[model samples]
Target chain A: MIAHKESGERIDPTGIKIGMWLFLYSEIILFGGLFVLYAAYFHRYSESFAAGGEELDRLIGAANTVVLLISSFTVAASITALRLHQRRRCICLLLFSLLCGVIFLVNKYFEWGAKFARDLYPGSETLVGGEPGLNIFFGLYYIITGLHGIHVLIGMVLLTVSLVWVVSGRATAERYSMLDNSGLYWHLVDLIWIFVFPLFYLVL
Target chain B: MSNQSLEQQQQEHLLGYRQLAVVLCLLLLLTVVTVAVSYVDLGFFNVPVALAIACGKVSLVLLFFMHLKYEGAIINISFLSTVLFLVIMIGFTFWDVAFR
Candidate 1:
């Protein structure tokens, strides 16, 4: 319950952390709904879904998994650094995490671009046309991955804001609740990928 | 607490950092195991094996990296409830779809 000298703002770091946890719960449900839909359809077309999943490039998925996992580690390390009052080290780790996030998005861009070029996208315009089940599987695939990508984008922005907070001295060892919360968000992004990796790559 | 108490905080911070690194190494090991296991033709057990490994990795991250293990029980309860509700929702959906 420390008070800021200049602004007299009572910094309740625990409250902010809890708020972020609650928000994370909501996000879980949001994505949980999409997962339910995917599972439902997947049950109906298990073979088609497996076939569609096999069509995906495992190397790219593996690389992206490695990238996101590294980013998660960097962000976690940044939180530890911030807690230690090592502001410079914290900022460096945050920057590294952010760079990893960018690499993930770049990989995703190329992956999606290749899929688009091959017309593997959902809807009637799919390249592998005439197969109803495959089309449905691809439809769910796009929706789920698209939503996960949006979450990654949001996580990147949150990390950027945290980076600014560090540079501006708004965040410090005693006042870095924002960095902790952003770390949680970044971990969620990674968690989603954990599920995605198996569903789209290994399950085939 | 005085701002000058930064030194004490630094020690605790190092402890946290070391714990995080240990957990990260474990995670990497688990990931490697998961990939290796997937290559084997375990048939029906494949999904379960992958998911079991994933759950272990997630538990490590949640407990150590996210500090949920040291946090108050209330936070754990809150997270658990959310997971329970999610399970119920998914179960209901499955029952409805499968039965129909």
Candidate 2:
């Protein structure tokens, strides 16, 4: 506890984690609100939801799932690197995780691009004239996955900042809560995708 | 008696790279299994089955990757309550939809 003192007192890692968990709770509830909509629509329109889901490329979805899962691994391992006093390994691993994030967003870009090309967007001419259930299904799909994609981008920034700190020695073994917290945030992104993958791509 | 060193606190629960690699492999395998199972048409059991596997993966990430397993009860209690309330909220919403 020789470092990271505030007002002559050592800052508590547990307290910072608690604050992060509280934010995560709010995040859970935020997504829960969307899940509730999904539940209602899923109950009333299983057929259309299935149809909309069928339009999704499970191979791509599965690929992104693998990508995020690997990113989660690299991010976690980066923390392990930090703990072992392997600063260069930590930086390399975080860079690898950021690469995965870019890969994810690129995949998402193409996926959404294909959809937009087909006018599969909300209130678009093609989708608007289709079954109301399909419309609702894609609506929820875009919103949920769109929001999760944003989180992925946010996570990349967090990891990048942490990477800078680690490189500059601001985030060291003695005081590396930023790296730990960034890892936690990254895992939460992975956690949400664990649900998102199946609900949209698998359960068709 | 109350002055446990920060180094000791952190080092006590640090995970090895081997453990992280194992968890990663298991998660990837479960992803494969879940995708494979989806093609089998498990009827009404499909969603629940997929979700159960996802839950297993989530637990591994939380316990190992997030280090919740080594954390104190305050953090555990807070995190668990979030999941608990999420379940309650989703359960009640489904209940209302079911009977209404």
Candidate 3:
């Protein structure tokens, strides 16, 4: 293991953070574009969209929201713990956060499974033969949630790397941007879910 | 990298367990409130109310969990601009649709 001092290189925290934020900006716009589509489609088919929303399981949606929110909190706390030089606590919190991500994905799997069983997916007979607005609704549902699920998987990978680095002493109290930035990415995932849950499940 | 920088690092705010827990509780509470409000059938206000609550929840996540409160100006402006762009895109689409 190359010691941080032996490397003779310094991490610019501010620069690293700005880069991450810039990347997050793009993610926002990416999701934002989809939301714009949702807005336009909703304006055209408000009644059908609302009716479609009524059939979704609100209980599962709310449960996933709670899970992500809790994960975000744990990620934030883990960073704080690292800064405080509490390594064990940091690892525990990060593991918990990863577990939260797993739970969220499992819930999503079942949720999508339920929809598939109902023949509600895009281009399926039910959606294809349904009202046009319901078509758009389910279409948006699959695309948005599927894309978000990919992000959750990406986040879990980032978290795992962060944990490994932290354990290896690559992420120390004096320098922990790896873990810090990982936490930020995790929060962005959670942040997107915060809006997504309400838009798709609560409001539609 | 310097001693002064290390000094500043030590001084940086690290929220305690209690405080982070409080933020979690607040987020969860907002979730419950939003879910409850959805059942009321508030006519045209339902969507708006739900979106408003969502914005509230996102703000909390940004300010605390994302540490926007402690971030520098560049990041703050970057995030703000992204939000501005999004609002304009969605708003303009709605405006165009409204007149149709």
Best of the candidates, lDDT: 2
- What is residue A111's positional error in candidate 1, in angstroms? 0.9
RMSD of each: 3.5, 2.0, 2.8
For model 2, how does the per-residue alpha-carbon lDDT over A94-163 read when each residue is reduced to its tens digit? 9999999999999999999999998999889978898999999999999999999999999999999999
Count clashes in each candidate, considering only residues at least 3 apart in sequence or on different chains: 0, 0, 0
Chain A TM-scores, all candidates? 0.93, 0.96, 0.95
Model 3 residue A147 lDDT?
Answer: 96
Stretches off by above 4 angstroms in model 3 are A1-7, B1-11
Best by DockQ: 2
10 residues in a row with least lDDT, candidate 1 chain A: A1-10
DockQ of 1: 0.39
Q: Higher DockQ: candidate 2 or 3?
A: 2
Cα error, residue A37 of model 3, in Å, equals: 0.4
Candidate 2 stretches with Cα past 4 Å from truth are: A1-9, B2-7, B10-12
Higher-ranked by lDDT: 1 or 2: 2
TM-score, B chain alone, candidates in order = 0.78, 0.90, 0.87
TM-score of each: 0.90, 0.95, 0.94
Q: Which CAPRI quality tier does the interface of model 2 achieve?
A: medium
Evaluated with TM-score, which candidate comes out highest? Answer: 2
lDDT of each: 0.81, 0.90, 0.88
